[model samples]
Target: MGESLQSIVNLVDPYTLQILVNIGIAIVLALGLNVITGITGQLSLGHAAFMSIGAFTSAVITLRTGLPFSANLLLSGLITAFVGAAIGYPILRLTGDYLAICTLGFAEIVKVVFLNLDITNKALGLSVPPARSPIPMPIIVWVVAILSIIFVCFMKESRFGRALKAIRDDEIAAEAMGINIARYKVQSFAVGSFLAGVGGCLYAHFLSYINPSDFGFLKSVDILSMVVLGGLGSIAGTVFGASILAAAPEFLRFMSQYRMLVYGGLLVFLMVFRPNGLLGGINFTDLVLRAIGRKPATAEVNERHRK
Candidate 1:
């Protein structure tokens, strides 16, 4: 009993706190990815590129302008959103594997650009000052993540979200119904990129160091893994997926050389058993309403957004 109590006390340790921060950041990333890949049915493998842009943008802002953390976060997100809007307009024209390949190529281009840029310090990376935060890092991270999740939940039920879903479900049908496919797709990409930028900003500030390699192909894959592991369209699922994947490496530390093998095997096993994800098409919003003894609308409850 005493050991159990002692164990709980260790949850606030620096290492644990850092882990918490990582999980929160991952949740934020996954939330953004869901907007594109999950809801809009776009396959992107360059999410980390957007993240890197935000990281560098935030670092530069902090180092040069002396802005506070919140301002930097907002500015970075807006900048990334603009980039996404401009790039997504043309890139989102592709679909399926073609879209994935283009986005992946775009990621490599971003990485190369960052690696050559003098302001980013080239290959050596950038050392950033910590955010001028009013509260603890974990609190700030989780607060942003939680607010992002809530906003997504509300967004999911909004007309914009429904249009994205319609596009995802049947793009031709949606176009025939008068929905502007190109516009909605670009909007989704921009919004998702904004969230990814915010996540990257938080990550850079939390670690006080970042580099181009940090947001490479593998990092994009990792974020996608979280969204996949959780139900793709489910916000609650992103939380679960991010938490589990973020803590997985630490928990597997004892395995050393074999940890990655085990991790790969675990993901394979989960996918084989649950192809649609752990909670695919299961809306937590409906679950919440039911939990509180107020049944959600029949259409809402019956909605299945996952493909």
Candidate 2:
């Protein structure tokens, strides 16, 4: 089945296939940010820094140690997670804008460090190996993306998730309930940063080149936009938003110089109408039934409970 799928994919135009792969990579990054900012309610702006670290780490591993791509992926994520824990420990206490400022500052520092690194060629960047997996690049990207979504969904339904939710909704109350706020916050960042590193692996492999400039402050803002556009705490929404934003530039290219203007306009329109997200709080089954002049039994039960 995998071979057949790969063969079918091989028939697609290379440029279009690369775009699809890009969408998958964006989804992974958005999901990671969703964990830190959405699920855990911690505002993080340094996500792109982690991605930069992952790309360099994996590329270096392959160039120096000649490790397989899979090992590089895992190792890169582990290394980034350790960095996240160490950095997260110091600044996790600040709330609101203060936390955001600290994270943004940290992101710039990482970028500057990468720029001066001899191994990275100091802004010249490094060439990365393409996907060396037994499976095709598209298939592997899809598998990783799907598995990430599933894992996050499951995590949201676990006891750890409940604690995170409480922390998000009411930090003081959560602490009163005996939740370890500091520990949980750091752990959440570690998990989120690990995923960001994995995403960097996919992204670097996709482009075959990466530099410090590639993961700058603007890149971090773009990622944060994906989460906000999708819906905070909404995994499916994040995927939806990432896919739309990823493809929007391609579709809007025909507008020439006005393309970005139109793109920004569209995001503003969506936020005005569906502030929660394009799919947040929406159940397809219930939506379809409502459109057909009927309602699902669960919908009726929920309405009754609300009353």
Candidate 3:
């Protein structure tokens, strides 16, 4: 099945395939940010920094070591998670706009450090190894995207997810319910950063080159926008949002220099009209259950109590 899928992908035009690959990467980044800002209700503006960390780490590993590409990606995520945990420990205490400012500052610091680092090849950037197979990159990228979605969905259904929602709803109330806000907040940050790192690895390998400029504050905002537009805590919505945003530039080529203005306008429209996002609080499972003529668990419980 995998071979057949790859063969079909190989038949696609290079431009279209590239767009699909980009969409996959965007989905990964958006999903990661969704975990932090959506599910966990923490505002972050330094996600691109974690991506840079993963990209640089994986690129350096590929250049210096004989390790396989998968190993490089995994190690990059682990290292970035460690860095996120270290940063989150103290910074997570700050909420709302303060946390956003600190995260933005963190991204700048990472960018500057990368700009000066010789190992990262400075502004020149580092060349990543090409994909070994004709369809290796797209396959790898989509695989990671699928895994990220599944991981986040599973987490959303778990006790941990409930705790996250509790904290998101009311930190004080969550604490009263015995949910450890501090530990959960740090964990959410670390996990979100880890996913961002993995996305970075995929991006670096797909492009075969990366630099600090590629993962700037603008990139972080782009990712955050996807999460916001898709609906916080909605994995399926994130994927949809990523697909639209990633492909919008291609479709808006006629606008040329004005495309950004159009993009900004769209965001403003969404914020004003659909502040909760396109699918805010709606899950795919709920849709499935409704389609099957069954109420979701919560709906069923409500009906039962009413009866």
Candidate 4:
């Protein structure tokens, strides 16, 4: 019992805790992007750019001004959202391949700027201040997770979400119904970007490192893969997908050589066999309870139980 307690204590050390916190932040970032690209049917290949914006802005503010973490995070998110809205005004007007190309180009531009900027240290990377207290990681993770869940729930039930869905189903019909399509799209983009910015801020702090290469085209592709593999527009699926994708490489460390190749092949097979993804847009929680012969509420059972 003493040994076990010691082992558990070791696991709770500052570094390990920070890692878990960073993972939580990653989930938020991925989920926020998932909402925009997955549920709302917006295709942005430049999400990492927005993330960089948030990270750099937050880092600069926190490092230079010595502001509180909350203030830095909020300001960073807002700044990133503003940038997103500005970009959305023009880019959201394009659709299909046109939008994809534009976003990709935008991402490239951000990368170039980061690499060439004299003040950004030209790829040497920026270091964030060290965390102050023990259990900081857990505190940050819980805060970020709670905020993300709240925001997601708000968006899911809001009239805005319904409008976005309507537009996704058929933009022309949504517009015909007098929905302000452009406004909703831009709004979604800004909200999603803001969430991504928050995630980035957490990431920078956790790693205590920031670099242009961290937010590259491949990073965007991996994020998109998580959404698609999870199932477009499925919230529960996003969680499962993100967890799996994030942990896969680590879990398959034994595979060593062909780990990624195997992962890619499996993805291809999934696309062929289960295009909707492993969960089929179904919530894992609901599926688990159903498998054990429990339903949410059946009328016959309710009436008989009452008797």
Candidate 5:
């Protein structure tokens, strides 16, 4: 058993570890954003604002004060959550295109602030201190992954989560049911932004460097695309979508100059065909249950049968 374990350990290296770590970070970010935009029906084109906030907060705390990584990450999420909630109060009332523009402007404002901020060294990237040695990157990745899974599980079960679901189903009906729609909307955005911020902190530590430009409009759009392409309310779909979108460019590098063009074309086709995404709203858990021959609740099954 010892020899087998040693062999298994040898099979995984730092490069593989890094890839795993990045995937965890991506899942955390994509799923969090999906909760708000997909389930709650909010449009936030400024998620990168939360990301930048988290990155800068962790960087500053770790560099200037020598705080532990765990503390910095937690605090980063908290700070970003507060910011998200505060911003959501006024902006969530806007609908559709207006909301998108407002969030877009919020992101630009954040970028501009970071650009001129002296404490962050402006455009110069912050250098992260190395993590305590002996603990491999894969272990950290696993920890982050477990945390993300737990966060999603809890959110799915929580009352606030149910409120978001209600809002998604029908805002008018949810309001009629006495659910405070605005409160839930803001809470969803805050939680989503908090997770995105935490993901950013982890990403910064993984990359060991970050700049204002790194968290630009494209980053926000990329994350938003992951949420949309993954399906509005499906956690597993979001993960799959994020992984494919993030890795496709690199995987197709062999295609040379035309790689991007082909990749873009493929995306268009995917959207056209699988408009709801791979597992939109139906996560791996649901698939597992189905594979075990479980069916939807009796009422739902009966309703479908009647239809």
Candidate 6:
């Protein structure tokens, strides 16, 4: 199976392969943001900050410790999760646009800090070690992306997931139901940041470079758009959204001068026409089940009972 997969990958052009890897990274970022903004109803615009943390941490570890890429990736994610928890604990008390502002500020702060840090090589950036195999990095990215999607799907159905949904629907009601709002919110933030960090690690290795400019507020906005465009709480929707957005720039390369304008216009159109996002609350699994003449488990039960 591995040999066959490698053979297929080899048949693809390098440019296409690069785009696929980018889509994989975008998927991870979109899903990570989905956990906090989509599921937990938290508004964070500092996701790229976490990604920078992971990318820099992984790059340093690769250069200094000579550790394996897997180890570096894990450490980067752990560190970013810790940072997310620390940040979320205090700022999560704020809600709505205020929370969004704070997170955006946090992203700017992270960018500035990295810009001045000598260890991060300052604005010049650091080059990462090249991958051992020609196709290894993309494969690793795809594997991580798949695992992240599966994990998030399962999480969306778990007890904690329900609590998050409840919180998203009605914070007061969720609290009344004995859900630890603060605890769950922090957990979601941490988990989401962890996934972003993992994506960052992949990105650093793929490009063989790291810089704060690469993870600025614009990057965060791009990731957020993917989650929103895909359908906030839907994993499959996020994947679809990420793929489309990731490929959009390449497809619009011919209109280089108007690319961003077109992209922004498209987003505005989507927001106006499909405010709930492309998939919204619809689950792909439920659709498949219905197509197969079967009811989804949740659909079979009374709404109150399911809740």
Model 3 residue runs over 4 Å out of place are 1-6, 131-135, 288-295
Off by over 4 Å in 6: 1-8, 131-135, 287-294, 302-307
Give the C-alpha miss distance for residue 88 in model 4, angstroms: 0.9
- Tens digits of per-residue lDDT for model 3, 2-83: 5787687779899999999999999988988888899899999999999999989888888888887777778999999999
Point out the higher-scoring one by lDDT: 4 or 6.
Answer: 6
Residue-level lDDT of model 4, residues 6-36, one tens digit each, is 3654668665564466557767877778777
The TM-score that candidate 3 achieves is 0.94
Provide backbone clash counts, one per model.
Answer: 0, 0, 0, 0, 1, 0
* Candidate with the larger TM-score of 1 and 5: 1
Q: Where is model 2 more than 4 Å wrong at Cα?
A: 1-6, 254-267, 282-307
Give the whole-model CA lDDT for all candidates, comma-separated: 0.89, 0.86, 0.89, 0.76, 0.79, 0.89
TM-score of each: 0.91, 0.88, 0.94, 0.84, 0.87, 0.92
Candidate 2 — what's its lDDT?
0.86
Lowest lDDT block of 10, candidate 1: 1-10
Q: How many backbone clashes does candidate 4 have?
A: 0
Residue-wise C-alpha lDDT for candidate 5, range 130-239, written one tens digit per residue:
54334444456557767776677568657887889898888999999999998888888888988988888888777888899999988887787777767778877888
Q: TM-score of predicted model 5?
A: 0.87
Q: Per-residue CA lDDT of candidate 1, range 1-307, in tens?
A: 5355435545688788778889999999999999999888999999999999999999999999977788899999999999999999998999999999999999999999999999999999999997876555667788899999888989988999999999999999999999999999999999999999999999998899999989899899888888888877888787788899888888878886785577577679877998778878788678778899887875554675431
**Residue 201 lDDT in model 3?**
89
